[model samples]
Structure formats: structure tokens, C-alpha cells
Target: MNDEINYTNNPLHGLGLQELLTQIVDHYGFEILYAYLNINCFKTNPSIESSVKFLKKTEWAREKVEIFYLYQYKNLPRVSSEQFELPPRKRIIPEGQTPREPAELSFEDAERVREKQAKKAAEHGKSKRYKEREFENLWKR
Candidate 1:
């Protein structure tokens, strides 16, 4: 008797890439997607066909879109650290966790997120430089 539980509960299961992109684009529009994802394909002369082609050629970008689709479009709860490391499509949804309504997203919110990320990156760069300088001083002493 097979005791293994089927873990194909992921919303991405059996979904095609083009279909996924189409759904998100139809709902969110390219501007919002570009704002949130920062993908050039969405920002420059955006269309479903061209974006799909670019995503197909780019693995990392495709994964980014997949993650966006799950957590943003589907509004699924964040996964655990172990599952978080897996690709969004490969991750399993825990039992009893059904997708909720799509989160309300706006270009303004995306702008805020981008600004916060930029600020954090700047701070991180400063701290790294400070630490390197400190290490060099230790060697000099």
C-alpha cells in the first residue's frame, strides 16, 4: 500500500508559463509587474508574446515571475525556510492552506518598495566598506 501523500497542491502545478504570465498581465498590467519585478521585458515595449519569449530564455527572470505569481497573485502564505529555498513551482503548499484573494498592489507601493530596497542596499554597501576599512586598520596595527 502506498503511504506517501501526494504533494501536488501547489497552484502552479500543471500551469503553463504563458498562461501564468497572461493571467498576471491581464490582472495587474505590465507597469505594475515591472514596478514590482524590475524586469526590462515588462518595462520596455511590453507585450505578452515578447515577455513570454524573454522569460523563456531567462531562467532567473522566469523564477522571479513564478515567485511573484504565487505570493502576489495567488496571495499564498510564505513558505518555511526549507521550502523557501526551492523554486516556487517545486514548493509544496502545506495541507489546508488554500490560496486567498490576490493582494492589492499598486505602482505607488512598488515605488515605496524600490526606494526602501535602494536605501537598504546603500546602507549595506556603507557597512561593508566600513568593515573592510576596520579590518585593514587591524592588519596595519
Candidate 2:
């Protein structure tokens, strides 16, 4: 039994159109690639298929695509062995820093607010009675 060449488990293998576009973008500026590819996707939201179609048909566009592929491979960001972690920073306060004073509502003010709320509720009840009169007429109809 012969083991066939696996396309899946390979470096820089099975590169999809979107991935190819993204990699090319990361390496070369969008404007340069747009000029090179002459594809609408590169210029004004041209799709991968449209770009691929243009490139496949035109040799110049195909050359640009090859150049982009090479650029992407060369300038790929190296995977760092060292993991990046944010340093545990201690928030420092000045030596003479004072805490804010606690806010407390006075009993007289509280009572006044309660009385105002009761007055609003009574007003609301009066308005509600008028609305109920309309509903009673509707029910009769």
C-alpha cells in the first residue's frame, strides 16, 4: 500500500483564497497589490474569486500574485517562544492622599422627598381615573 502525499499536514500548504489575500495584505500595502493585481477586490472590495479569475486570465496579474505569495512567505511574523504577559503593576497613591467623604441624606430631606413622591402618586392616580373613564365608555360600546 502506497501512502499518498497528504496536502493537509504540510507547511504553507492548502492556502485558501481569503488566507492568501490576508497574507499578501500583511506583507504588501493594499494599494501596491491593487495596482499589481488590477482586480476590483484589491481596489474596491473585489472578491478572491474575481481576483483569481483576473490573475488566471492575465499573465501580469498572475506574476503579481506570485510576487505576493513570495512576499507573504518571506515576511511572515515569527512565532515567539516566549509568552507575552502583562506585568503586575501596583497602583501607587500619594503619602498624604485622603479618602472621599461618605455621602448621607439627612432625615428632614428624606421626609420632604417622600412627601413629594406621595404628591406625584396622587397626581398620577387622578390622571389614571380619567383614562379609566375612557376605557369604561369603550367597554360599554
Candidate 3:
């Protein structure tokens, strides 16, 4: 009979809103925890201690806190992996157009590409693009 109200055999034994909020804040900083929860407690001008008091009175806030705890901390059933995996779709390449396979880049080819990129970056850096732009602005002043 007691099982009807609570989770498992102990419905009356769940942690309240304050407890859940405290745990979340302890794990993640107050700012981040508040951002994710999006409750008035964290958003209010007062600090976490004060916010806890305000949150305790609000039934809706308490419910959300409890739900998040139950879902994440309490090991609730997860959605099936199948939900994330996309179904296979047909690839349609035009018959007349040849689909070019990617060029097999050897180790030498990769090293050459890297060296070229490094040289390009060095040239760009030496150009002092920022200094050029700042000089124009400074002269305009």
C-alpha cells in the first residue's frame, strides 16, 4: 500500500527540492546549475542560500527540481539507442557524373601540405595585419 505513493518501496523517502538543488550546485557551480535549471531561485538577486528559501515555497519549482534529480541522479530508464541512430538512406549519384574517390594522400603528401600551411601562416603573421588596421584607425583619430 505504501509503495503506491513513492518510488519503489519507499515513496516517502525521496530527497526534497532543497536537497536536489544543493546537490546540483555542489556538483556544478551556482551559475551553471541555475542556467541549466532556469529557476527563479538562482536568477533572483539574492545568493544561493537565499534562493534555496524561495525555491522551497514554490511547488512548481520543487517539482522540476525533483524531476531532474529523478531523471539524472536517480538512474531513471534511458531512451533507447535506436532513437539516435539514423536509418539507412539511399545515395543517389548521377549515372553520367563519375563520383571521384578521394585522392590517396601519402605520408609525404601530408608532410608537404603541413609545411605549405605553416609557411602560409608565417607569411600572414609577418604581414602584421592587425598593426596595419590599427594604424589606419589611429591616423583617422
lDDT agreement with native, every candidate: 0.76, 0.41, 0.42
Stretches of candidate 2 exceeding 4 Å from the true structure: 1-12, 26-29, 35-41, 76-141
lDDT of 1 by residue, 1-141 (tens): 121333467888889899999999999999999988889999889999999899999887888788788878888876776776676677888989898878788878788766765666566675643432322222121
Ranking by lDDT: 1, 3, 2
In Å, residue 29's CA in model 3 sits off its true spot by: 2.3
- Count backbone overlaps in model 3: 1
Tell me the TM-score of each prediction against the true structure: 0.81, 0.31, 0.42
The reply for model 3, stretches above 4 Å from the true place, is 4-12, 45-48, 78-141
> In candidate 3, what residue range of length 10 has the lowest lDDT sum?
84-93
After aligning candidate 1 to the native by TM-score, how far in Å is the CA of 7 from where it should be?
5.0
Q: Write one digit per residue (lDDT tens) for candidate 3, span 14-52.
A: 545456666656655555535434566676663656766
lDDT of 2 by residue, 1-141 (tens): 111232222223455545766665655546655543344657876666676666557654554454334323332222212311111011111233332222222445435544554566566675643432322222121
Tell me the deviation in Å of residue 59 in model 1.
Answer: 1.1
Residue 100 lDDT in candidate 3: 29
